[model samples]
Target: MRETPDTPSPRSRRAFLRDAAAAGLVTAVPGLAVSACSGAERTEAAAASPHPVTPAASSPAAGLTSNGYGRTAADYARTGLTPGTVQQWEDGFRTAAANDDPDVFEWWYSDFTGDDGTVVSFTLSTRLDDGFVPEPGEDRRRPRSAVIVTDPDGTSHGGTQEYDWSEFSAARDRCDVRLGPFTFTGDLKTYRMRGHSGDVGVDLTLTGLVPPFRPGTGVIYFGDTDDHFGWLCVVPSGTVTGSVTVNGKERSFTGHGYHDRNWGNRPFPYSVEHWRWGRGSVGPYSVIGADLHLREQYGSATVPVFLVDDTKAGKRLVGAYDTRTVTATESAPVPYDDPAYPRDYYSKVHWTYHDGADRADFTFTDTGQRIVSRHYLTSPTDAQQKALDRLGIDEIWYTRYATDNDLTLALATTHAAGSGTGTLEAAQFGLADAPPRTGSSAS
Candidate 1:
């Protein structure tokens, strides 16, 4: 059994902010600090799988305050809350939060997989900070965008760019955002996105096939503090018709796509230890799953959220938030190249959701196609690097994998089983101390 680390006392918010500023952790754009490096390519081989351990069932501890964290079905029933409803304004720009504090951050994300095996993903983000100390006529709240395109032949092309704030604008009443030459606009039913990075450009239209979904109130509060994280799947499953231009050559195609929005008031390292998020379309069902592990200060809780939409029947089969009903097991550990912590990370994960007679199982296995791998703290100054060491923030690694998915669903008298391709992401903010490495490791 994996041992749970001891819970640490909560850090003062003011002190955290001080350290963050000292380390130059704040930036004009979110997710751009990473140092991009590709992992070694390897083929899959059969290995012995570890025994799965079931998570202990626990009721909400006293004084726990949250909308969707560590709550059971009965708890939600008392609050008269069902799955979730789409609010037009929820998909709009989070102007209030973005302007409230420098620590708050927001971003829009979308991706499409063509029928011919090409994949395109992109993000538009608001600033995470005004500036370390602004100079005259300097606006650090500039908007930024990134794009990644992987052709069917396995060639990848993409990059990131930051734009002046004057070139950025967003509507508060709907899903309309413009950053330089990039534009992402949509209602609940349909969306249009366009962006360019380096030699690649994408213009796509996505029509929704699954209704929008939120686990509960769409927000997870940390204890009694005002700090929280929010997420909404605007386009769970959609059809995409678009053209991708690469190296002065343009090609049009039809494909499937997914989009979602995320916003939070606190730095992710301070709240989240790690998470596994993924979505897929199998047979007649569209499924999305996330397993979030909170930091020790937040009771080290594991929150599992899942949604299964029956597109053929035009109804949702399950919208689960309770950790007791939804569970995840990680296996098939593989060592990655982290000198500070020579530990193995899981390359295979299985998720299961069951309530009474209804049950669903989804498994994702990495096929060795690592599209992204980077260290979050890129090119820190000498003083900033020292501050990071003081805070025990060693290596923050983010990796994305192209995966093969196997899904089985049995709801009442309906049954479905299928396999497909999808995307899975793993992020590590911190790790326990490990012995010094005597040799190199492979991913």
Candidate 2:
């Protein structure tokens, strides 16, 4: 298992910040908008097949936090929580001990896409060692935030903002979280969000089109220590109506939107190689899914779960054994090298899915790359870096891609086909940046 990226104690707090500042670690702003020569996006067709792991015979029971752990919805049901939002974003854990663990992390996430091909995403998140919980004796650790607003043309303006613990707050009763200049508030039915960094400012509102879908106790404990992590999909699919302003020009946009909550004890890469997740809208049908490949020791807990709103069956949640992911080919790999990197990484060309008898396909091509060498630069302290080094990791790659859909639903007596459009991505972690290379790494 990968090591947690956190500072264990507050004893050397001042020296920690000084070293981070010295290595340009504490700053969160992204670099200038120049295209950093991305690799190609086409070529060798990979044979298609379902993920190697077979489906599980049984699934965990779904319910409220009776055992102090929230569960995923076994089937679609209206969430009884207040409309605006659940306390998951702020108070996601079942125990005060987990909440106070600096190793734990939480973030409110949403992605907005304009009809004109502009994509904007913002996340207000932080590791919990310091004072994330505001209480008489709580630790007062600040949080870090990141925002990226990229247009179809590749023009972008956005970066990260590190906030002092005093500037972060989340309502105990609703989905109101303030991280310095960024604020996200509203019930799950509707939410207003605002954030400004560098030369970019994003002001958008998400209105629900589909009711919230919570999987059976969303939390999962995969390690020997049983540290748990969970996700809540407040707005599985929604409508985005707002504007993204870059420089002084503002562009209004309208499209489908997605908002969700992610909180856990370890970064995903620690256990998962990567995950393919996306939400698409076609008429009244809202489609979404998540396929995961667990890395090494964490393979035992891998599962695939997807939610689809069908006019005939309403909305139902399905498990991995109930679904299949087949890759017809892989696009050119967006090259990077870190001499100490581990694992063999490759691009996914056109990925197809079959949910039991229903089916859909999406084709994605590399559009842009976000190179945040921050993770590899130095993780807060020499000790943290050394720990990461033992894991054979350094840099991470998040390459954005546009998606085209081809689908054949089994809803009818016979499989029926349809088409749609959206976005998808590929993530590479714990690898060193290599000299520019492209194409498949196949022999």
Candidate 3:
């Protein structure tokens, strides 16, 4: 397992900010700072994956405060929280070159073992850029596709599927996915994903890459914030592949197990194409979940889309939420790095929507989260370049929840009555646990 990122006692950010500013790398805005280069030369491709591991530079400890989180705008690009505006520009760039908008840009794969050692796994990703940028050459759109699998370690594996239309089709929820002869079901209750790599099959680890910084480029953000959602939890499966017997049947799968949770609190209004998700326990009973939201510019509006895994039955549109009860909380610097930073750490949250006949009372807890700080500089004209300035996003998240439910959640950053007062927004809603699995495996 990789070493966990540091969750300092709120003071470390100041120190990091001071060092960045002292190096003559200050952002014009007081609310955020630019990440300075350490004079280390890096490949252009690798530059996008900044700050691989700065958490180790801090002091080690037992447990961190439960409510600890961040609101850093610079960390956006480094983490994978694609703001709609940034994606809009990137889509424009792709349009000018590829001539075809990609159906899926990002994905997630997760494997978990339930308490009984029943290996369970899932994957999810986006399809067709209905709301994404189109290629300069191609005037038509294609369907976005995604897939997921479970019991990867069982005699018969299980999973789900998804597809999206760019033109005029409702987003298809849980569709069935075929793995060789056996078929897996899809649902909104699970996360799903798909991607290409000349390589055969890839491991769906529950971690994402953080981009490195470039002066004027922009930061990267990851996790489920503002407008996306993907969270999967694992309880007790062990590592190792191959078939295993469960309920008198043998099975086969590809990965190991770790107790965990996966969920998001992203805002809507931003256009997103694809995503992948997985969850693991950062602490006992407490889970740590992560998601990747791929954004591409559409037209006038930024559409935020998501992909989920339905591990139980033939999937359909899962219950989702578009809530209005969001609330924000502001905080101050604790005292670690830079003192000039004056922005309050904002955590905008709303209740999860529950689907029921009588009362619509629903909820999901964001058990824990950590910040991935990033800094960059960029011009506002180029989508990739423009992504740098407005690209800075605060991705505060939770990995574990109280129950297993299907829901569409969101998080967002809103301007406070004016043009540029940055306010962080985060929210989640529980949709439904979904009906139980039915019928036998499909072929």
> What residue runs in model 3 are displaced by over 4 Å at the alpha carbon?
1-100, 103-113, 117-119, 124-383, 390-443
Q: Which ten residues in a row have the lowest lDDT in candidate 3?
A: 414-423
Measured against the true structure, the TM-scores of the candidates, in listed sequence, are: 0.76, 0.64, 0.26
Rank the candidate models, highest lDDT first.
Answer: 1, 2, 3
Runs with alpha carbons beyond 4 Å of true place in candidate 1 = 1-64, 67-83, 128-141, 337-341, 381-391, 433-443
Residues 408-436 of candidate 2 have per-residue lDDT tens digits of: 45533434556666555545444432223
RMSD of 3: 22.7
How would you encode candidate 3's per-residue C-alpha lDDT over 1-443 as one tens digit per residue? 01115532323433554555567554433222234323112112211222221111221111111111221333332223222111111111111121132321322234444334444444333222222221211222333232222232433333343333322121112223332222223221222322322212323322211111111222222222112222222222223344433334444444434322222222221333222122222111111222223343422221121112122221211212112221111122122122322222212121222233211211222222321122221122244233323433322122221222222322121111111111111221110111122322212
Taken over the whole model, the C-alpha lDDT of each candidate is 0.66, 0.51, 0.25
Query: Which has the greatest lDDT?
Result: 1
Model 2 TM-score on a 0 to 1 scale: 0.64
CA displacement after TM-score superposition, residue 295 of candidate 1 (Å): 0.7
lDDT of 2 at 276: 52
